[model samples]
Target: MKFIALFAGLPLLAAAAPTQRALGMPLQGDLCMPFQHDLGTPLQGGDFTAFAWFEHEPIHPPIQARGLRFWVGGEPATYCPSPPVVHCPPGKVTAFSGGGYGLSVMVPGGQRVYVSPTGELGYTQAHSAYIPPGSFLGPFEYTPGIPFGHYTFNGKGFIACPNSKEGPTTWKVFAHIPNAIVPTSDIQDCLPFQAVTEIFGSPPAAWQYT
Candidate 1:
C-alpha cells in the first residue's frame, strides 16, 4: 500500500498564516491528502456531504448502547454539547467519550457506508478486538486540510479527516497495520497507501483550507 504523494506539486502554507476555518468536531489528528474513495461515480457538478454514524456499548458495569451522528455539509446543523459549557473557546472542538463502530457518507445518489475495520470503532482502549467498540471518541476541534494521519485515544486508534474526507474514503489499512482486517468492498479504495505520519510533532506541508 502506497500513499499518494501528499505534498506533490503543491505550495506549502506558511506556519503563521491563518488557515481557513469551519466550526465542527475537532478530530484527533491532522488530515491526509490525495484521499481516494469508492462512493460510486463522482457527482457531476453539485456539492455533496459526508457523514459517519457510530454505536457501541461500554464494558463497565450497567452497560448501555451509545450512538453519535456527524455530518460534513448541507444545511447548518445544531451541535449542542451534552453539558453546556459556558467558557468553551470560539473554535474549540468538543471532546467526548464512547466511540462509534459504523461509518457512512451521504453523497449525491444516496448514503455510502462502511463498518469498523474489524468490529466497531470503540471508545476506550481496554478491548479485545483490533478496533474496540466505543472508540468513536472526540469532537475535538480540527481545521480542514488534505486528509492526513490519525490520533490515538488511550492507545485505541481511528483515522481522522475533515467531514469531506470521511467515510468510503480510506488509506491502506493493511499496509499500515499488517493484521488489519478490511472489508472486500473497501479494498479498492485502500491502495496507494501513505505511511502514517504523526501530526503531534508538526503539521504537514500542504492541506486544503475550508
Candidate 2:
C-alpha cells in the first residue's frame, strides 16, 4: 500500500505583501508568499512520504495563520479524507477509524495541534502556527511583517509498519525549516515516526507559472 502524489499539479495563487505587524519589520515583496516544499522521505523506518505548501489568502484583517496544505503520498491518510486506510494488517484494529493517518503537533503557545486527514491537511484548532504564543513546535516564532523564518513542527503519525505486529505504528513526526538543524534536546522521543514539509520560504521559481 504505497501512497500516491495528489498535489502534483495544483495552481499557485498570487500572494499579497505582509503587513508590518505580520513580519515585525518591512522592506520587500511578499516575504511569506504562498510556497511549497518537498517533505523528504520519512526519517528512517517508514514507507510513506509527504509534501506541503501554503494556500495564499487575501490580505485583510490579517489571517491569524497561513493555511498550510499537506499531501501524503497520493492519497490522504486514514486520519485525513475519504481515502481508505493504507496497509492495515488483516486482523488489527486501527487507532483512528477515519481511514487516513493521524497527525498531532506540539507547537509553542501551549497550542494543541491536531491535523485531520481530509485529503488536504491543515491545523484544526489553530489555523496558522504564526505568533509568539503559537510557535510551530520548533525553534522559531511567528513575527508579524517578517513572514520569512524557519521553524520545526514536532508530532506523530499513525501508519502501517511493514514487518511488525503493530497494525498502525505510531511514528515520531518532525517538519523542519530547510537546512535547520534540530537540537538533540528538541527531538521527540517516540517511535515509528515520519517528518514532512522540510523547508518553507519563498515559492519556488517553478511555481511562479502555476
Candidate 3:
C-alpha cells in the first residue's frame, strides 16, 4: 500500500505500514469472505465482531441435539439468557485474518485457538476447538487483508472440513456452519437457513440441549 504526504513543501510518496488482512484475495484463492444471513450481508473491510454457530448433532457420543454457537470454552457456552455477550476479541488475534499469513488467536483468559500447520481443519492440535471471540475480519479496510485461519499456512488448502471428525467440522463457512441447530428449550433466537437435504447426519426430529 502507498500513501501521499508533503515533506517541507514538496510532494512525497511513501509506503504505508504493511499488515496481513483478508481482502483483495484472488477469486481462486483458498481464503474467501464469509456471509451472514441475519445481517443480510457479508463481512466488510476492517475488523468486526462475529458470532459463530452451528447445529450440534448427537453423534459425538449421543448426548442431545441442538444448535451451538461459538463461545469461549473456558468462559461459558453461547447463551441468550437475557442479553448478548459483552467481552471483546483480544488484540492481535490473527489466524485466518489474512490470505497469506495469520498472527494467532487467543481467548480473553489466555488460551489460544490452535490451527494445523497445513491449515486444513483441526481440533486437537492442542486440546479443544473452543476459543474466544472467533471473529473474521479484514483488519485493513483498503487492502482487503485476510489472515491464516481464513485460508491456511501454505496458502493452498482454503481451510475446510475434509471429512467426518476432522474437528470443528466445516465444509467451509457456508452461511454460518450448518445453521446452528438451536434447541427449542433455549429462548435465544436461532438464525434461519433453508435446509434442502443434510442436517449433518442428525434426524429431523426435535431435541433439547442438556
Candidate 4:
C-alpha cells in the first residue's frame, strides 16, 4: 500500500538544530520528525515519539513500527481491571498510584491496559507475537535527544507523554532491526504504520499537571 504522511501537532524534529544527533539504532539516518496523534491538541510538556528503521539491502526508504512492550515500573504488565478507572487499570500496576504512569496496550486489533509506579516505559526488540508468556523484560530507559531502546527490527514504540514536559514528559523509540518476515518483495506491504492514543492525567487537578 502507498504510504501516507501523518501530520499531527508541532513537528519536534522540524526545529532542526545546526546538527542532528546520531540515531543509535541500526538505521544511520537522521531522526524523522517527532510524531503526534490527532486525537487532541498539542499539549506542552508532552511530545509524541517514534523512529524509522532503514531496511537492509534491497528495500529503500526503510520501515518502522511501534515496538510496543508493556512494563509497570520494574515488572511486566498484567490485565487491566474490569471497571478500568483512570488512576489504576483494574489489577495491573505498571506505575505508581498517584502522579504515576498508566499504560494502555494496543495489539494488532486488541487492547490491554496496565499501570506502573516507577515511571518506566516498556519497549522491546521482540514483537508482541514473538514474546513468550510469563516473561518480565525490565523497563526501557530514555536517553534525552536519543532513541529509547537498542537497534533491532523495523518495529517502533512510544511512551505516553501525559505529564508536564517541563519536568519529565519524555517519550522515544530506539533500537531498529530489519523485519525477517517481510522480504524485499513484500516491503511495500510492510511499510511503517501506527496509531497510538495516550491520555495523561484524569481531569481537574490532573489537567494542571498534564
Off by over 4 Å in 3: 1-107, 117-152, 157-159, 162-210
- Which portions of model 2 show Cα errors greater than 4 Å? 1-5, 13-111, 114-140, 145-173, 177-210
Candidate 2 at residue 59, lDDT?
13
Most accurate candidate by lDDT: 4
Tens-place lDDT per residue, model 1, 1-210, is 111233123222223322122212222333222222433433221111112111111110101112222221122211222344433222112121111111111111222112233422222111112333322223222222233222222223232222123444322222122223444433233321111111222111111101
TM-scores, each model vs. reference: 0.24, 0.19, 0.21, 0.26
Report, for every candidate in turn, its global Cα lDDT versus the true structure.
0.23, 0.22, 0.21, 0.24
Location of the lowest summed lDDT over 10 successive residues in candidate 2: 91-100
How high is the lDDT of residue 123 in model 1?
26
**Model 1: lDDT of residue 170:** 28
lDDT per residue for candidate 3 within 1-210, as digits (tens), equals 000110123221122212233322322433333211222343332321221211221111111111221221111112122224343332221122111111122322222112222221222212233432333322112123222112222232121121223234222212122222223322122221111111111211211111
Return the number of clashes found in candidate 3.
21
Scored against the true structure, residue 69 in model 3 reaches a CA lDDT of 19
> Residue 186: error of model 3 in Å?
38
Candidate 2 residue-wise lDDT, 71-167, digit = tens: 2222222222223534322211111101112122212221222322211123333233332232232211222122221122222222111222335
Error of 2 at 160 (Å): 17
* Model 4 / residue 187 / CA error / Å: 4.9
Assess candidate 3 and give its TM-score to the true structure: 0.21
Candidate 1 or 3, higher TM-score? 1
